[model samples]
Target: MEPDHEVLVVGAGFSGLCVGIRLRRKGVRDFVILDAAPSVGGVWRHNTYPGVAVDIPSATYCYSFEPNPGWTRSFAPGAEVRAYAEHCADKYRLRPHLRLNTRVERAVFDEDADLWRVATTGGEITARFVVSAVGPLDQPKNPDIPGIDDFAGTVLHTARWDHGHDVAGERVAVIGTGASGLQVIPELAGKAAHLDVYQRTPIWVFPKVDFAIPTPVRALFRIAPPVQRLVRLVTAAASEVIMVLGIVHYSKVPFLVRAVEALCRAHLRRQVPDRALRRALTPRYGFGCKRPSFSNRYFPTFMRDDVDLVTTPIDRVTPKGIVTADGREREIDTLVLATGFKILELGAMPPFPVVGLDGVELGAYWDEHRYQTYEGLSVPQAPNFWLMNGPYTVTGASWFSIIEAGATHAVRCIAEARRRRATRMTVKRGPHDAFTRDMRRRMRGTILAQPSCARSNSYYFDRHGDAPYVRPQSGLHVWRRARTFDLDDYSYGP
Candidate 1:
């Protein structure tokens, strides 16, 4: 089949929109953005759980190119973030090229035709290039508790929150104490008659430094956009310092980890003065072994009379309530599962199968080759295709930075292919292997590679117990590297 367009982007969220915006800026307009959902904002749109807001400062969590001057708070809420995505779509005039509620099932590279044959719910569309921006955190995971389906009461996963289900004056059981659980538990604690929080493992909680963005500051950002950029740079620098010194080198610099641990302990002590409660909340694993959460009210919410923290391991679930390993049953009217999303383990090949050259499925290839890729954007055998937010691309810094870097890299690659009038472009196997070797070497002594994470049930690690999701370097390094595409790393063909 001849190419229907120059490019076909498989997502409509931050990474996808960034691709469209960058492509348009580079004078490439023959492309379409397709999303499975009826709306934009991949994670922001799905996770409308109560008290959900950005953990990072709003100044740094946004696009470096497009600064939002009107954020109400230092950390914008999910709604505002979704609106910002919509604003970006409008600003870039992307709606005309966006196909919502259209899911791309599979995309196979036609070796002979030199085009990608994409199969979708809407219809099959061939393109010269395919950009997979389906985010890592888009797929929500449910717990594997026995008899989970037997729950007679309403069951809701925070990712698939049922707005219609009323939990007011009802006994609510929230499973998991991850980021989403921390945010939602606080909000639900106020409304539920009684809330039972099931915690399989304790998470390190830090005090959130959130406040309203004053009117004057917003006005200043509008008047001088450079001020907003300055704020972003400052925020980025601070985060980078901690990441490089503290997290990336936790084992080497114990004091750096201890200092942050001291702050976390102080926050917990201040919030929960009760000795027993504080002990229950104290994490046993290293600080960076598991993902840290930030919230001002999460600790204090436990002090409330209506909330109960249940650390007992769940044995099973009855039709009426949950059963603990201690053989105790707690009845609840509503169940909220905040189990979190499946990161990096996007079902081998997420959304659908992607077959590259010689009818080799991308999933099968990765399974045999161990997720080797060139800068997490292009795979060795995946010709004329790139994945945004792929394995080893996620970092400790703001997600927007990762998206921007990847989108820029992919757009430049496509532009180069067009400039050369090449029918196909595939990453060289030598570069892909070299990148993988470096990733494994750099990951040797990191916090995630430690023994503590083995039992932590952290999504950071791949099936082989290796943490392949994190980019093993500073966010700034990745950003700069992505800006300058190494054309020598790829092979162009006619």
Candidate 2:
């Protein structure tokens, strides 16, 4: 049977765009990129709240191939990141191949035909290959709070901010002190008449050394691209040192973790003078248990008289305000939910049903088998399907590195299938199992396996109590493995 397209990339985010660019470079033009959003940029496009910016240095946050030399700050703003995505789509000639506002509902494999029947909100389409690039953080997870719907005041999620609404002189309350909340709280402190911040778990806040990039440096990058590459290398190496030594090799290098914790504590004490507030903000879990944030203003914002940090547990929500466990109600005119995205959840990973061979659904398989993937790209029983961000795929390195590695692996398989004129390509179970076992063995050295992580309340650990979100390997090792992995691990058929 003839498929509608040669490949169907199931997202238009950085991961999807990277795969599309790779496919195009391979001279494969019969492909399409589908996204549920009305436009591109994925998370960057969705998150436009004030003070939204990259947590890492701008030098390391972008694609290695397409570095933007004109980043205004060390950490580029969300709008610039979105612009970069649009630029990539335009430069790579992916505009024509994009089908925006199209949500994938389900995908079922047709074994007899060796094709994928994909059902989307726009319509149904068949393709020879399907790449799930929906990303780990695409779907926003609303808080499971009682009487949330009964709130009469304006409610906004950090992921879906309402720009038209005016927040000035309004009594506002921000919930969840994660990355988004860290950035938003500072911006909202002076703007709102009175702001209340709800904290379920305190996070380790590191000092962000941010500054504007000089024009001459930008010019140097454009004139001599190698300079930017060097800068990127340095930035990446610094991140690798912190992540690998403090988190991945926690059992082996406990001192590095303690050093990082000490730095965080010193930064907190410097920014906040109130010892009681510092104690309230200090995290109970280990440093690497949950992802931390970098900010110069986050800790200082709590010192504002207009801002009040509410550590008390929220009992319920009234139409006008929030009720606490201590029989106190704080009236607010606006509510902001920084509850974060749906990660480590079955629904968000695929965001839809994907039926593979022998009536096995991808989510169901992960649920039963504990989320295993071969090289975090291919899986057994799922022929010609790849994931951009699969279980144990994300290294603590820059997201661009992860995307490039995953795309390389997926593209290599697709290229091999094309060369052999094979319609069905599935990873062998033996290799998959072996890889899973290796990852499990390496995971023992990471901080995720430590007892202190039980208090983290992190999304990294799944319901099965396994932190399969991160690959237990160095960035360089992951990149090398992606480029040189044995193709024989997969079985191709006509």
Candidate 3:
């Protein structure tokens, strides 16, 4: 049977956009980009909190092919990132292929027809190939605290911020001090009449080197694209060094982690004078165990007279406010949940039910056997299906690096299938197992395998005590491997 389209891309975010762009470039035009949101940009489009901005420098946060010279700051704000996504969509002429406000429910492979019958909100759509670009962080995870719904006061989630709600002059409480909490806490300190910061675990905070780009620099970048490329190279190299030494090569170069931890300690000492507060703010785990955040104002904000860091464990939420484990209750007018997205969970990995070959459910299989993939792109039985972001795929500090690598890998496979005039292209079990074994072997050298990481409360390590989220390789190595991997690893047939 002929398919509805040649390929059906599952998302319209950075991953989906990159895949769509690469597909078009490969002369494969029969495809559509579907997104659940009203517009494109994925997380950038959804997350619009007050202090939302890229944690990394703007130079390394963008695509290599498309660099914006008009960034106002070295670390561009969330709006600018969203605008950049929109710019990419428009420039690449992806607007015509986009189906907005469409959510994919399930996708089942038809063995006889050798195609995917996808079920989305809009109805059924079939394709010869299905690319699951739905990112890991697409679904927000709300804390399962008792009586959370019983709160009569105004409630807000960092991901789904309400623009009309005013927090000024109101008593506010922000829960969970992760990346979003780090950014929003500083912005909420002075604005709210009184702010209470609930902390389950303290994170390593580094001073962010953020500043505005001068007009002259912008002009130079625009006129001489090579200059911007040079800047990207330097920034990317710096990020790669941190990922390699502080994370991947932690066992070999433990001093790098100590140096970084010392810097963070100094930064904390300089910002917070109270010794007790400093002790409460320090993390017991290793530096690279959990994803560390960078912020100039996060630590300093704790010093504000109006802002009080509540280290006591939360017992439950009442209609008036939150009640601590020690029986201390704080009455507040508003509650802001800074709880982050679901990263390692089964629901997050696929975001929906995906039935592959022989009645195997993708999420169930991973949950039972452990999450493993071939180069984080293909599974053994899941023919004609590719995941742009999968287990053991994330390489560099910049997410763009992973997207580029995964896109190149997937597009290469698809191109090979076309070359062979094949309808089915599945990764061989032998190669997939070999790659998974190698990844696990390399993971032992990383910080995630350390005993101290057990206290990290990090989403990086799954329930199986394995850190499959990172590829344990440098960005350059991952990129090179993606391009030069042998096509014989996959089996092509009619």
Each model's TM-score, in the order given? Answer: 0.97, 0.99, 0.99
Off by over 4 Å in 3: none
Q: Candidate 1, TM-score vs. the true structure?
A: 0.97
Q: In what order do the candidates fall by TM-score, top score first?
A: 2, 3, 1
Tens-place lDDT per residue, model 3, 343-437, is: 77787787888899998999889988998999888997789999888999887557898899889999998999999999999999999999999
Model 2 misplaced stretches (Cα beyond 4 Å): none
- Residue 392, candidate 3: alpha-carbon lDDT: 90
List clash counts for every candidate, in order: 0, 0, 0
The models' CA-based lDDT, in order, is 0.87, 0.93, 0.91
Better of 1 and 3 by TM-score: 3
The clash tally of candidate 3 reads 0
Give the range of the ten consecutive residues with the poorest summed lDDT in model 1.
343-352
Q: Tens digit of lDDT per residue, candidate 2, span 252-349?
A: 99999999999999999999999999999999999889999999999999999999999999999999999999989999999999999998877776
Which candidate tops lDDT?
A: 2
Cα-lDDT of candidate 1: 0.87
